[model samples]
Target chain A: MKVNKYITIYKDMVRQIESGQRKAEDVLPSENDLCDQYGTSRETVRKALNMLAQNGYIQKIKGKGSVILDREKMRFPVSGLISFKELSETLGKETRTTVHRLGLILPPSEAAKELGTEADEKVWEVVRSRRIDGEHIILDKDYFVKKHVPLLTKAICEDSIYEYLEGELGLSISYAQKEIVVEPAGEEDRKYLDLGGFSHMAVVKNRVFLEDTSLFQYTESRHRLDKFRFVDFARREK
Target chain B: MKVNKYITIYKDMVRQIESGQRKAEDVLPSENDLCDQYGTSRETVRKALNMLAQNGYIQKIKGKGSVILDREKMRFPVSGLISFKELSETLGKETRTTVHRLGLILPPSEAAKELGTEADEKVWEVVRSRRIDGEHIILDKDYFVKKHVPLLTKAICEDSIYEYLEGELGLSISYAQKEIVVEPAGEEDRKYLDLGGFSHMAVVKNRVFLEDTSLFQYTESRHRLDKFRFVDFARREK
Candidate 1:
């Protein structure tokens, strides 16, 4: 596959920043210098820099060039339907998933409504706590329609349910609608997550659908207030 | 102007939902019936229904039809660089903006770092509180580089700074990077907003750039925790 020159430049710069070669507040070389170095046009360098700025890697100053941004906090992209296992693997951090509960139960009213299932329908409920660096930072409560996800186990819940659904069951996960709000810590959250005495937590509710437009899963992911950060890049519509 | 059939259908359905003709939990007509009503193909009707689902208007069930969703809470699109003025106008509700403070001051250290400006450089500081439905729900603190803005007035801050910047200053607003985090309510928030005794608030920090990729503005929008909700539509990357 032919790669775009600008994307190559962007990836190389990301590598430099991630490897600590480009420290925060350090301004990158001038566009002219980068153009000469990469044998590309000024427009190409600007494209790469724009990507960097959009992804929160750098800040573009009017006259001072692009300065690296501090990326110590984990950046959760708001526009991707990514799984927890996938995200942890990308971070390469010491993470552990503890399955607090895994069972088939009658769907809760809210979950049943969101999943478009009847109240009497059984749903696979999985409650897991995510511990990163020995701190429980996230508590995820997931409900999957039993008609679609017929089989689930504690082992799969501890590992990756998305992997089981997609890789093993061959379910085609297509799109999702997500809502994020700040809510007071619930009893379940307080019991599972090490909230560090915070009174509120960030709740991300997701209604996931399949390729056929069938609602299959409803997830409520509760995160410690201070441990949660969502980053998004938005372009102004003309 | 010519419009696509699917878009026309989508708009018509949106109007129906907005007018309360379709109540929450009401099952929409089946695809075949919608196709006949709109005199369009199944694909076009499906396109319209998909649009409705993606925008949180409805949820599609596997064997059943689409069901309307309750949209009582304001849905803030997480992927748009829209101003609060525009959003309020769209909501068409009783909204008021109060200018708390508007003046030029030395940029704070954090604002200076985000805007890539020196601490000595003066920046236009605008603090405004937003009241919707007779409740003070949001407090916004904005800093604009004086070199780019040149002039800012309390009236502009009270109305809409983006309108003034684009309409009068002739500066093109291009893109923004946003970070959403939950933080404890600060003194300013308590003083300016009716936080309803909530200890935490959702803070959205935006770094806005111009067409030339120059970071010109930094804004911190603080929202009452219970009054904040963000909705997004995401597709899986195969």
Candidate 2:
């Protein structure tokens, strides 16, 4: 498959930033210089720079060129359907997942509504807590339509259910609709997470659909307020 | 100006949903049926349907077509650079903005860092509270680089600064990078907003840029937890 030239440039720049070759507040080369260096047009270099800016890698200054942004907090992309395992891998930090509970039970009212399950339909409920550097910061509650998922185990929940669902079960995971809201920490959150002095948590509600567009899973990820940060790049709508 | 057929279809569907012509859980016409009704190809119809699904208007099921989604909470788009005035107008809600404070002063340490201001640089600080149906739900703290803005008034602050900046100042608002996090409600938040019993708030920190790619403004919008909702549609990146 042929990749776009601008994407290649974007990836190389990201590598440089991530590898510490490009430090924060460092201004990038001029567009003309980049164009000549990459043997690409000015438009192409700008495209790459735009992508960098959009992803929070750089800030474009009017006359000073693009400056690298300080990336202290882990950036959770607001527009990606990434799994916790994938996210942990990308962070390259010491992470562990603890499966608190795994069971096949009648769907809760809210989960039933979200999954569109009929009466007497069962769903797989999985609860897990994520620990990074000995700090428990995230509590995930997941429900899967038993009719679609069929079977789930604690071991699978400990790993990545998405990997099993897609690789083993041959399910074509497609798109998702996500809603983020701040809510008071519930009793379950207190039990599964290290709340410390925080009284509220950021809740990310996600409904995942298969390629055929069937809603198969509903997940609520609760994160400790201080540990949660979502970054988004937005273009002005004309 | 020529609008894409799919966008026209998408807008029409949004109007139908908003006007109550289409009810929640109501199944939309099948792709082939929509193609025939709109005199378009299946691909075009699918694009329109996709947009509808993406915007939380509908959910597509494997064999049952698309079903309208419940829109009880106001859906806040996560990837748009819209002003509060524009959002309230779209919501058609009784909203009021109270300018609690507006002044030009030396930039605050955090604001200075975010705006990339040098020493001795001044910024216009505007603090406003948003009332929806007589309940104070949002508090906005905005800092604008005085060099670019030049002037600001209480009237402009109470109204829409973006409007004044664009319409009067002829500034081209371009893009923004946003960070959403939950934080403990500060003293200012407790004083300005109707917190009820909640002790935390959702903070949306935005750094806005102009068409020239210069960062000119930094805004921190604090919202009551119950009143905050952000919706995003994301596709899986392969």
Candidate 3:
């Protein structure tokens, strides 16, 4: 494969960042400066920087210069299914769960429809705040069909409820239907996640299924916009 | 099927929106008001509202109440396989393409690598402004392998260059590798697309392959964040 000069420039910048020569808040060289340094046009320089930004190696703040990212991102598979505990474990990151609220609540009409149950159905409501690398990255609100996982509490919420269900209760999860969108962080999210007022969230609505293909749980994964990444592979001829 | 009251409330609200009983920008009742009106808890009330927000029925602004959406959504396929004309046609929305710049230019090193060509290779660079519903929503910069499309021009860029390539030039497109991310609107985009600073752009970068499995085109589709929607299939046990 022919080596691209811009890729060389991109790698060099990555090395600078990884080696701590360029600190997190240090401003990357301007496009014109990079063009002069790399002996390439402004377009080529911008293209290299764009790749860096997309890979989360840098954050390009408009008007301001690009800054090295504080941390490398772990690819969070939003498309495929992975329990929160498993994902955190896979990444080998310091993962902590804080249960803010949990209760037996009456489901609203809309949630009832999604859960394939009746309105006013009693459900286990759990609110969890996930902190990764010491930063609160996700706020999750899960509603479980009471029949599947009954008698939830704040202490149980702090633990992996999915683990308790499948391990202790022997309940099996089958599948889920998820809807993903970009939405702004709301007041409730701001209180827990400390998200900037301008920050948008990657909202995921999932209707979880049981082993028998029954709707058992519904979860909403509100991801910090900058932290969420989804990737997939396809054949060149597929 | 057992009936769920929350779902009943959800359907009722959806009907009100769909039937035009509730106009766009109108605020629904607050959570406290809804709890009393529906005789449900705050969580139950929010359940219905979250559904409304996810399905594009309303916008939740922090501090401000939820505003009903106009529902004039222009859907873009996440497949990333369609040409500009095909995409516009699929959306069934009025879209005009303005050929801002088109010329035979030397490909940058990165473009050459993606195209499987050499650095400084002769390539056709076409810059076009895409207008959806009379508003410029995207500014695209497309690079085509000159070896593939030998005689591309500005006139070709004006109206579905992909159509001209397939119909007249007779080069069949087969597959593509696409990457998408949120990016701040650039100078050219803000100037031409008339987008304000409040929103970002969904930037899609694709590597197009021909019928022979040869990479031939590189396209960047930048869409306004608020207007962008992505839908895909995922299969995994919850």
Best by TM-score: 2
Candidate 2 deviant stretches above 4 angstroms: A1-74, A108-110, B1-74, B108-110
> CA lDDT, every prediction?
0.83, 0.83, 0.70
Docking class of 2: acceptable
| Candidate 3 lDDT (Cα, 0 to 1) | 0.70
Each candidate's interface RMSD: 4.6, 4.0, 10.9
Q: Look at candidate 2 and tell me the lDDT of residue A178.
A: 80
DockQ of 2: 0.49
Clashes of each: 0, 0, 12
CA lDDT, candidate 2, residue B60: 82
Order of quality (DockQ): 2, 1, 3
Q: If both were scored by lDDT, which would come out higher, candidate 1 or candidate 3?
A: 1
Instruction: State the lDDT of candidate 1 residue by residue for B1-238, as single tens digits.
Output: 8789999999999999989999988999999999999999997898789778756678788898898876654366644689998888777789999998888888555555567787688888888999999999999989899999999888788888899999998998977778898888898899998988788889889988786667799999999989988777666755
Score candidate 3 by DockQ: 0.10
> In candidate 3, how many Å is residue B135 off?
2.7
Superposed by TM-score, candidate 1 places the C-alpha of residue A127 at a distance from the truth, in angstroms, of: 0.8
Q: Chain A structural similarity (TM-score) per candidate?
A: 0.69, 0.72, 0.63
Give me the runs in candidate 3 sitting further than 4 Å from their true place: A1-76, A89-92, A109-116, A147-176, A209-214, A234-238, B1-76, B109-117, B154-175, B209-214
Better of 2 and 3 by TM-score: 2
